[model samples]
Target: MHRPAPTHAKHCCSLPSPCKECFLVSFARGGSWRPPPCPLAMGNTKWADAGQASAIAGRRRERLIPRSGPPVRSECLDGKRGETGSPHQLEGKTMKAVMYTNRRADRILQFTSDFPDVDWAVVWSPEEFENGVADADLVVLSNRICTPELGAALARGRTDRLRWVHFSSAGIERGVNMGLPRDIPVTTSARAKAPVCAEHAMMLLLASSRRIWEIRENQQRHYWARNELNFTMRSIEGQTLVLVGLGGIGAEVARKAKSFDMRVVAVTRGAAPTPDVDDTVPRRRMCEAFADADAVIVATASDPSSFRLIGSDAFAAMKETAYFINIARGEIVGESALISALRAGQIAGAALDVAEDEPLDPKSPLWDMENVIITPHVSAAGSTNDYFRLRALFAENLNRFRAGRPLDNLYHFDDGRALPATN
Candidate 1:
């Protein structure tokens, strides 16, 4: 279910600590419940309650530290700054950041108090957004709302003051294609969604192997079909699993698949071996890898090069008993060819979290296909933690930007694609 974007702008200055009424209201909205900050710590306007505030502040500060180490990119800094990891440089300077998001303004506004030196403007309506973009020193936005017009506005509004542009979501291909300025540094919250998405991929993998849909049908009919299921159900243990990409989500999936004792084969553009992958096959030799797999998963970034990358030829290379699972973009697969492959028994079954067309046509043949399980792009759902993780990443980057340090998950545009950050 999609909520309509808010029609007004909310500045952080007037925002208050979450109240009991706010909790009740959020709970009434069904699945929107997020534990508000401790009232004792945030109730006072100055947030002077040391005990609770100190504990929470410690956690927020920990999030700013990189898991590996601080990222370093000389090109991202100005020569005058001398690339030192210190907070003293930005002491008196006040920066302005304009953010466009679907999340409620009040919810996001609550965090702005931590960055008192930075002005925060959370805009949802188009009119407010255009004005906000023109004056912002930093911009944080969602790609879903970044249309061509908004992208052009961002390009025209770019000033020397604008240091960085951040996408709240991992995928920025759409925003890049929409004419985002090439000069500004762009970053994304790429790894934030990895854990949950990888879990979804594993869920689909398990469901496919055990023929979970058939088991559910038996349950619906009140039939004890243990004898029938034992003969048909397959175990994933010791089977070969092919991964098409080794980005954040793909790498996480590889780690999880290893726990199930599955042999992992990775098909990637790079020659380097991935962490848990048993074999590394070049992208051009993906068909060869497909032939040796019991199941194949697509987790590549969607770009012009990957559009319809998986089609009849790739499907023909797979074993008749192999399952196909795609937790990536649907445009990466040839829909008609996939349907034909399933009809011809080229593959046993498929589990998809995305489709070539979103809100897939109810009349589409894929919906009626017994060999296919379709989820409405909900692989990243059911997690409030992702929201906080993204907020933490944004806050950490803001701190980096203020300190003239290299940002995490920076997006490169050399190949006309939003390449994921190496760090």
Candidate 2:
């Protein structure tokens, strides 16, 4: 049967929608629960029946939609089904949501603590659909709420009345992992990661150029290589750096690359000039960039379309003398292709903050390579309020959401995935 479009989406992305990602961390999910009535749902013309008043529906659990796919960008790979198929963005309103929780009661409280104005419900023990869970304007999926059932419940809970979603961590891949509906306006806390990742990129660049890891390895072998021929340090000044996928992290990477006087060229789907970019090229021209740059950095976020965005052919195009760095997600680069690139010297060397796999196995050959430098995902690690700094930005956005102001950090909704390029 045909249904109407979401009334709230029309207002969702105006201005800079920066504060929406933290809503994910605050959702309190229950097995088979009903979603809260969205404040914006009132404006929607797709009513279950006229005179069926939301007040009556609020007394009983009304199923507005079904939870059938991934949490964010969970649009069917084939095609969206039902009335919820097309993308609907929520803007100019604070979406009310029930934050889910379980054993991590403290975390649940802390997650929603910042959003004091939100009328939130508490669930000590989850039921197979708390029926009342969906009574709010939106739902917050806290760290405690992770389950196939909860994912399903969330899908059902999303409604036109609900206008916002927030992800606790920088990645909504977890929501993707659980199969969320791509219909929702899902945003990740990735904006919060840019500055830290920028710092990480700098560290990796400096480490590779100065041969820090190599020096440490040589010292571990009870030898010195600082004065060795291959160990000679190179200054970052006057070097050419090409950055791929100039999103938040890439833009930040460019800002930092300037400290060393490196020339920066960026290739991205946006095809628009960024603040710190010297040249803004398209993705197809990336290989040409590789050939011209002395170092290349990949800082785009992860998604199915972005998987292995850089691979053998691109690597083959790089200058045999160029260095490569990845401060972005690992899947952006194909695994075997990268390994071969180093083994064959398609590129001079590489440094990575992320990998195709976590805890890169001890058996992995990349660890043995002399020119490669690797670190567990510590590129974003900073002491003190680093994490809260990210969350705080999101919370501030939430306040903006409630006030009906424009939002920042709005995700570009393509046919399905969230691309950096805005529609």
Over 1-423, each residue of candidate 1 has an lDDT whose tens digit, in order, gives: 112222223211123333222232222111122533221222112222222221121132111111112221111212232121233323345567887776674334543554444577887766677778776777878766777877766666656667788887777777887887668789877766776899999999999999998998999999999999999899999999999887667877898899999999998767356668898888789999999999999988777778898999999999999999999898999999999999999999999999998888899899988778899998877864565556555655655565556676677676323433232
RMSD of each: 11.3, 15.2
Worst 10-residue stretch by lDDT in candidate 2? Answer: 23-32
* Best TM-score among the predictions, by candidate number: 1
In lDDT terms, how accurate is model 2?
A: 0.60
The residue ranges of model 1 lying beyond 4 angstroms of the native Cα positions read: 1-93, 105-114, 416-423
Model 2 TM:
0.68
**Can you give the lDDT of residue 260 in candidate 1?**
97
